[model samples]
Target: MVVSSVEKPIAKQPHASRLYRELAPAYEAVWPILARKRIRAAIGNLELDAGHRLLEVGVGTGMSLDSYPQSIDITGVDLSTEMLAQAQRLVEEERWSNVRLLPMNAEELLFDDSSFDVVTSFHVISVVSDPRRMMREVVRVCKPGGKILIVNHFRSNNSWIARMVDSAGAVTRRLGWRTDLNLHEITADFPLRVERCYKTSPTSLFTILTATKLDA
Candidate 1:
């Protein structure tokens, strides 16, 4: 049940890549408290084993690299050259021979269909210009029965909070992501089967979602 890309109008997120470029150097320092543990938790939830080929979209600074087992093969992609530079440095510093970093768009992946055993992204869905398109690409490249994982903050179900977030869109755009993205809307049309969805972090502001690609 592979989903095919369709022509549709996707609202442009013009500042997203530049925002990450500007924040690349200070990103880890600024969000360490909120990000570190949650990232480890997301990677842990993947339950990757040796020889697995993992593709990480939006691999900013490669902060989650160290958490993965050394035996797994990893290819991480990001739109920001600066962020990929930081990730490259980390890969070298850690001498992670199993890892590779590239600058690419998640919405338009370059890989062949069913190329990887696992595909994951962290805090990235909200930042991409077209979350649904990016997700379709994720599913398209993942092998049948492969796992897909995503961790990010979604639009609150509470009406008041959701309205407030939606109203603050202009302000949040400068920060490189939307504050009111609907998780269900993003995943609704995809062919994958949802495995689980749960909130994480101290404030429970973010969610860890896991799904498996249906076997063809």
Candidate 2:
């Protein structure tokens, strides 16, 4: 997946919400160029139809809103109020009546089990405080046979590159994400069955991972 260039690490663990809050204003300007193509590739083939309920975790600024079919209902949650506010503005300005934005923690989703037909997170898992908890919550809220999609940068398999990225984790954390998160560890023991995995970005740094939730 798409790894960011290494920069100096910040000394302290910055508050997650605060980091996004500070980045919210500049997010749209910066991320669209870097993330749009990969995100579109990830959600483009979802089997959405009218009445389908979709939940997006860590839906920063709602950049992916336009990619979904208008017939589907969408609920998006993020930890940053500033990001949600921007998302709200985009939803209103674009007149996407089917979308709703809320400030929420991905690790502690408020919805009941099987509440949604689809669950997705774009460029989010690597940034969350607890990726395992976030994935579990995503799985919990999705219906059996539902699709769960994730688009993010995973650590490189190249030993040298992986080592460099892992060594730079302290610096990358300051920018709001880790560079060395292992994809296998993230999906370990999860109930979902892998359906597809492919590189989505031109540089092959970002990947699209799709899975189907199995019956209980």
Candidate 3:
């Protein structure tokens, strides 16, 4: 998308970057328990083969890095360099030769079109300045017939539950993420098909969605 220098200020998430940068270590400590199992399960469901190219958007602290099969090539990118540093240390300590981590914005990925066989993003869509832009980038970089997997909390179809969450949108927005992002709206124009939508557990707020890009 080539975000301009002038627009960069608005594009860069001051509050979100600061919060995640300072708390990168703490995020490593706390987020895994809540997400590891689900992320692993969803990636597992993809049944990725050896040599498949995979890109993970917003790969904070490399939380889901270990879950991906070592046989596949993995590229993980995030806007927070501090978080990337944390993820880098893990990549080094684990000696994951198949994994590469970089600092990049989710909404403006630098790769060429159809660059990867699979794409993933977890708990990150709502944090970007433009969720739909991020999604568009995801679709652009994925190869035809490739796969896309996203795990996030979107506004519920259930009016009562959605209303309760929407009421908190102002607060969450200030805190760095929005609570009222609609999944359908964000995904409607993409050339992807939703194959499955599920939760780690019945009560979990996050939805793990799997989709496939239509063949060229």
Each prediction's total of clashing residue pairs, residues at least 3 apart in sequence or on different chains, is 0, 5, 0
In candidate 2, list every pair of residues with a backbone clash.
1-205, 1-206, 2-205, 2-206, 9-171
Model 1 reaches what TM-score against the true structure? 0.89
Model 3 poorest 10 in a row by lDDT = 1-10
Provide the overall lDDT of each model, using Cα atoms, as 2-decimal numbers.
Answer: 0.84, 0.84, 0.86
Top of the candidates by lDDT: 3
How would the candidate models be sorted by TM-score, starting from the highest?
3, 2, 1
Q: Per-residue lDDT for 103 in model 2?
A: 64
2 or 3: which has the higher TM-score?
A: 3
State the lDDT of candidate 3 residue by residue for 1-216, as single tens digits.
Answer: 222332233256656777888888778888898888988888889979999999999999998998888999999988888998998999999999999887788888878889999999999998888889999999999999999999999888889888988888888787688888888978897898999988888767788999998864
Candidate 1 per-residue lDDT, tens place, 43-66, comes to 887878899999999999998888
lDDT of 2 by residue, 133-152 (tens): 88998998999999999988
Model 1, poorest ten-residue lDDT window? 1-10
